[model samples]
Target: MPGSTDEPTEPTPGKPSAADRAARVAAMRRTERARARRRRALVVAIPTVVVLGAAATVTAVLVNRPEPPSLDAVTTYEYAGGDHVSETVTYAENPPVGGQHDPVWLNCGVYDAPVRNENAVHSMEHGAVWITYRPDLPAEQVEELESAVAGETYTVLSPYPDLPSPVVLSAWNNQLAVESAADPRIDAFLAKFVQGAQTPEPGALCSNGVGTPTG
Candidate 1:
């Protein structure tokens, strides 16, 4: 059929359709949303990692901390407190952990001469630990005993005429006999017995009492 001039329709070059523009806008929105979610997740993860790291450090410290050494060789005793006597009294233990004692307590320090049993026992009531060595102990060993208790208070060191062992450390209700001044138990006994749990009269005066200390 003959007709006026007509042509097929074609899309213009270098231009997008309305549907293509709408799809690109939707894709940009999805990408921006994904980035926003990643930023939020990163914010939450940073604090969580930091908290976990701090907790791990604290746990390691607790697990690695050392425990106190055990004191097993020390000998324990049981005695009542505050039994004062004016006359000389016999004791079950040679140094007397605790028993009838003079009202006056022997002052605490080293003594070249022998300390009276009654007075020393009184000092023990006041949380004093007495270390006695046999008179025949070597001068060097005696010096070692003194060194072991250096910078310490409430300790009595004296020479005993006849000791069952070379050295004897006696507290209120505890005692340890060591053959040498170098014995490790000496320090342990002092640590546990000076104003220790066994003290019958904890915090009593070791000074301002009877018999001046030689040292």
Candidate 2:
């Protein structure tokens, strides 16, 4: 053994030292902590962005909205006739004139009501009298109605002039007849206008006695 040329032998196992293993574990823990921090930041940031966006949308909606008009400002009238029929006409806050039709004209009562049939029945029998006398209508347009219903005319029961603004008119026979107009009137013979009817109650006819029946 003293004369052998080989070097003294050492252990040949292939495991890491204590310091190298500890360093590797520390690096893995640091990477895990970094990933957790990223996840938490994403959760908080996404909701914050969504909430801010929703608030901005609601603000835009409120700022761009328009105010609505008041219904209480309109003037209304009630007219009566046979068969327990009655009609109500509502005038626009700003009534147009001279045979012009305004969108504000609408029938607010039942068709069987005395006043409901005034304009609807007469206009059908005669012509577009409501369109002829609207406050917004020009004199030329009113004349046009005369031409349209030249030979065939019906009675206008309301005292108000045919003009642009809603008005209620009526005719009566076996069934009550009523018509509505933003503006218009009918032309017919006096006797023929009331051929088969009785007169309506005085105050129950026009608005504050301002309109007179023409049939």
Best TM-score among the predictions, by candidate number: 1
Task: Single out the weakest 10-residue window by summed lDDT for candidate 1.
Answer: 58-67
Q: Write the per-residue lDDT of candidate 2 for residues 1-215, one digit (tens) a residue.
A: 89989997653344333243334334433433444466332222122234655643212221121212222222233322332213533423212111212212222112211232233332222221222233443444333333323332233322234432433222321111123321212222121122212333222222221122322
lDDT of 2: 0.28
Prediction 1 global C-alpha lDDT: 0.74
User: On residues 115-156, what C-alpha lDDT tens digit does candidate 1 reach at each position?
Assistant: 899999999999888999999999978877776666556889
What does each candidate score in C-alpha RMSD? Answer: 34.5, 37.5
Name model 2 segments beyond 4 Å from true.
Answer: 1-82, 85-132, 155-215
